[model samples]
Target: MKTSECMLCPRQCGVDRSVKFGFCGESEEIRIARAAPHMWEEPPISGTKGSGTVFFSGCNLRCIYCQNHEIAVSHLGYAVTADKLLRIFFDLQAQGVHNINLVTAGHFAHQLIPILRQAKADGLRIPILWNSSGYESADTIRMLEGLIDIYLPDFKYINPKTAKEYSNAPDYPETAKASLAEMVRQVGAPQFDSQTGLMTRGVQVRHLVLPGHAQESRQILWYLFQTYGNGIGYSIMNQYTPMPQMKDHPLLSRKVTAQEYENVIRYAKQIGIENAYTQEGEAACESFIPKFSGQPQ
Candidate 1:
C-alpha cells in the first residue's frame, strides 16, 4: 500500500512517506527490531511462559532517555511484509507464549490491521496486546478497537514541560490521557484466564519513575486511579537507566534514586491502587534490555 500524507500519529507530520520517510522515519511497510518470547512483562501477561513480543521500529515520541533508542530513534531494524508478520505471530504462538505483544507499534497501525485479521481467522487464539508510548490520537485508537485485546500504554508525564523537555512533545500528557481513556473504553477492565493465569483483555497503564520526578509519577497515578478506578492495572516501573547519550542532560543523566521510587510506590499504596506491579532494587540493569536479533523474513 502507498503511504499517503502520513498523519497516523498526533505528530501529523504530513510528509509523503510513500516516497520518503516521515518524522517517525518509517514508511508504509512494517519494520521490526525483534520478534521473540519476552519473559520480562508483568506476571499475568508473561506468566510462567512468555509474551510473544514483536518490537516494531520507529516511534511517534522519541524520548531522549528511551531504553529502546536503537529501534525508536535510530530506526535500526529490518522491514517485513504483513504476511511475514502473520507467520511470525503463529510461530511465536507455537512457542507456547501466552499472547502476542506488539511493542511500540502505533506508527504501523494501518499495516497491522490486515495481519491481525488474518491471524484471527487462522485461529491464532492468543490475546493481541498493543504496547504503546501513549501519544496516540483517540481517532486512531478507535480504529483498533476490536483488533486489540489489551492496551499496555505509558502514562509518562502529567506535566507538559517535562514531556516537551524529554520527548519534544508539549502535548504528550494531554494526548496520552485522551488516548488512554479511549483504550479503557475499548477494553473495559482486566480479565484473566483462570486456567493459565494469563491476561485476556484489559488496559494496563505503565509509568516509569524518573530520577527527581517522583511527584510527577504520583500525579500520573492519581489521575489514572481517579479516572479509571479499579478497572485498570498499573505497572509502576523503576527501571530508569540513563542512556549513553543522556550523560550531559540534567535530569536524564542519572538513574532514579531508591527514595524516589519508594515515594512513588508509597503514593500508589496510599491511593489504594491494589492491582499494581513494581520493580525491586537494581531492576534497571542493562541485562533487562532485549536483544534486537530478529530480522524480516
Candidate 2:
C-alpha cells in the first residue's frame, strides 16, 4: 500500500510522503532507531523481564526539550522492511520480553498495520503496546482500534500556548484529549496478569512533570481523573533532563524541581487517583537513556 499525502497526524503536512519525505523526514518506508528489550518502562509494562521495544525514528511533534532528539528530530536511523521488523520482534520475543512496545509510531501508522498482522500470525503472543506522544488524530487512532492491546500515551500539555512554545504545535492539548478518549474507548480499562503483574490491555496515561509547569501538570491530571475516573492507569514521570538545545529556553534549561513533582503527586492523591505510579528524586538522573546501538539477532 502506498502512503497518502500523509496527514496521518495532526500536523497535516500535506507533503506527498509516497514520493518524498514530509516534515517528519520519513517517506513510506519504516525507519527504526533501535529494537531491543527495554527495562526502563513502568512496572506493569516492563515487569521483571523487559518490554520488547522498537523505537521508530521521526516524530510529528519535535519538542525543544525532547530527550531522544537524536531519533525524534535529527532522524538518525535507517529504514527497514516490514519483514525485517517482524524478524526483530520474534528475536526479542525469544529473549523473553513481556510485551512488544512501539514508541512514537503515529507518523508511520499505515505502514505498521501489516507488519503487526504478520507478527501476530507468526506466534507473536505477547501484548502489543502503542506508546506515543499525545499529539494524535482521532481518525488515525480509530484505524488502530483492535490492533493495539495497550495504549501508553503522554499528556504533554494542558494549554495550547505552552504546547506551541515548547513543541511548535498549538493543537497539542486538543488533539491529545480527543486521541486519549479514543484510546480509552478502544481499551476499556487497565487489565493485568495476576501472576506476572504484566499489563494485558489498558490505557496508561503518562504525564512528565516539566520544570515551571506544575500547575499545568495538576490540570492535566485533574482532567484525566475527571474524564477516565480510575478506568485508566497513570504514570507520573519526573525524568525531564535539559538537552543541549534547551539551554536557551527559560523553562527547559533545568530538571524538574522536587516541589513540582511532589505537588503533582499530592494532587493525584487528593483527587483519589489510586492507580498511579511515581518516581523519586534519583529518577532525574541521566542513567535511564538506553544505548541505541542496534539489537542482536
Candidate 3:
C-alpha cells in the first residue's frame, strides 16, 4: 500500500511522494515527532498508565488555530524506517500503556498498514488507536478496517463556511460525516474492559468548542446524538487554546470562554448525549500541548 499517487488523504494531491511532497507536506519517508506515553486523552484512552502515543509529522488539514503547528505545519521531525516504527510500538507496549495511539497518521496510513499488521502478528496485544483530524477520506478509513481497534476522530465543524475559515477545508462537514460513518461501521459500538474501565474497542468522536462557535458546536452535538444515538462515545472538549500565531486573529486570539463551553456542554446534555465526556477546569491552558522533541524517545 505504498502511496505512489498519494491519495491516502482527502486532498488527493496525486503527487508521487517518492519524488515530491504532497499537500500534507510530507514525502514517502516516515517522519515522527515523538513516541511516548500520553496522559491527556479522554479517560478511557489514557487510563491510569497513559496511552502510548506516536505524534506523526505533517497534516492533511491546515487549521489556522492548530495547536501542534510546530510539527504539523513546520514539519519538525526526524525520519525513521518502518522497521524502527515497529520497534517503537513494542517499546511503548512494554511500558504498560493502555493502548498505542497514532496521532495525525492518516497521511501515512498506506505505509503504516504493514507495520501495524506485523506488530499484531508479533504479539502486540494492546489496542491500536487512530487519532486524527476529521479531514479523512472514507476510502482511506476503509483501508484501516481490521487494523485499528479504537477510532478517535474530531468532528470539527458542521458548517462549510466555518470549516473553510478555520481549517481551509470547506468539504470538512461532509468529509468528516462520511469518514465518521465508516468509523462506526468498522467499530460497531463502544466496549470497555470490565476490569480496568479502559476502552477496548469502539469509536469516540471528539468536538472542540471554538470561542465563538457555540452554535456550531451545538449543531455537531445534536447531529452526533441524533445520528449515532449513543452507539459511539462523545468527547466535548473545552480546550481550544489560542496559539501564539493567532494572537492577532479576531475569533481565535483568545481561549474559549467558560460560558461558551458551558453552553455547549448544557446543549449536549439537553440533547440526551449520555455517552459523553466533558472537560472541566483550566483545560484551555497551553500546558496540555505536548513539547515536540525532534525524535521519538
Candidate 4:
C-alpha cells in the first residue's frame, strides 16, 4: 500500500502511483463512485437495513463484461480526502447500516488502510467488509488482516482461456484460489448475529454466471466445495447485464438464459453445496446497475 511503488495487486505494475498511473489506471488520490446503503448484497450483509457500501473507482482486472464498467474502465467518480472518506462512513453508520463495505478497492489500498484504521479508532462499530474482484495478492490481503472483518470476493473463472478472454488474467483460477484461502485463514468461519441476522465475520465468495459458460461455473462450484468445504459462503450471481459497450462483442452480446443459470444451480445441489445463494428471475436486467453519479452528490 505504498505510494512510491505500486504493487497492490498480483500484476505488480510498479509505478509511482503519486506521479504515474499503473495497470489499474489510478493515481495517488482516492476516488469514490458511491457511498450509500446498498441493499443488493447477501441477506446477512444487507439484512433489513443495508450494507454501508463505498464503491471505489477503477479496478485491478478489467473484465470485459463488467457491470460497473463506467467506474471500472472510465473511472467516473469524485475525489475525496481520507477525512472525507471517514465522514462518509460515519454518515452511513448513522443511517443504521449493517456493515461498511469497501467495493473494488484493490487499487486504492494504500489510501484506504489508514482511513479504515482511523475509522475503527473513532468508534466505527460495524463490521468492515472487503468486497473485491478476487484478483488480489496474498501480501496485500495479509496486510489488511485484522482491519477487515468480512471478506466478500468474487471467484470469477476456473478456465485460463475464459479468464484470459474475459478478464485478461490467465492466472485467475490459481490467484483467486490462494486469495480465498488466505481470506478464510484470517476470518476463520462464518459467524452471524441472531437478532440482527447480520454477518459478523466470514468469507463470502461470489461468482457471476456468464452467458455460454455454464460448464466453467459448475467447475468453479466444485472447486469451492472441495477446497473450502462450507468454510466460505457461496453466492451464485445470475445478474449479468449486457452493457451498451459490449454490443458487438461475441459472448457479451447476449443475456444468460434461465437454462444456463439453472444448470449451474442444479450442479451446486448435486455436488452437496448446501451453503449457497442463487438469484431469482429477471435479475439480468440493467435496473440493478447503479448510476455512476451516485446519491447526494
Model 4 stretches astray by more than 4 angstroms:
294-296
Which tens-of-lDDT digit does each residue in 54-135 have in candidate 1?
Answer: 9999888988888988888787899888888888999999999999999989888887877888899999999999999999
Error of 2 at 28 (Å): 0.9
Number of the top TM-score candidate: 3
List of clashing residue pairs for candidate 2:
none
Check candidate 3 and list the clashing pairs: none
Deviation in angstroms for 225 in model 4? 0.5
Between candidates 2 and 3, the TM-score winner: 3
* TM-score (C-alpha) between model 4 and the true structure: 0.97
Error of 3 at 49 (Å): 0.9
Per-residue lDDT of model 2, residues 34-152, tens digit only: 98888999989999789999998898888888888888877677788888888988988999999999999989999888788878888899999999998999999999987899999
Cα lDDT over the full model 2:
0.89
Task: Report the C-alpha lDDT of model 3 over 39-85, residue by residue, as the tens digit.
Answer: 99999899999999999999999899998999999979999898899
The model with the greater TM-score, 3 or 4, is 3
Candidate 4 positional error at 238, Å: 0.6
Q: What TM value does model 3 have? A: 0.98
What is the alpha-carbon lDDT for the whole of candidate 4?
0.89
Give residue 92's lDDT in candidate 3 (0 to 100).
92
Error of 2 at 119 (Å): 1.4
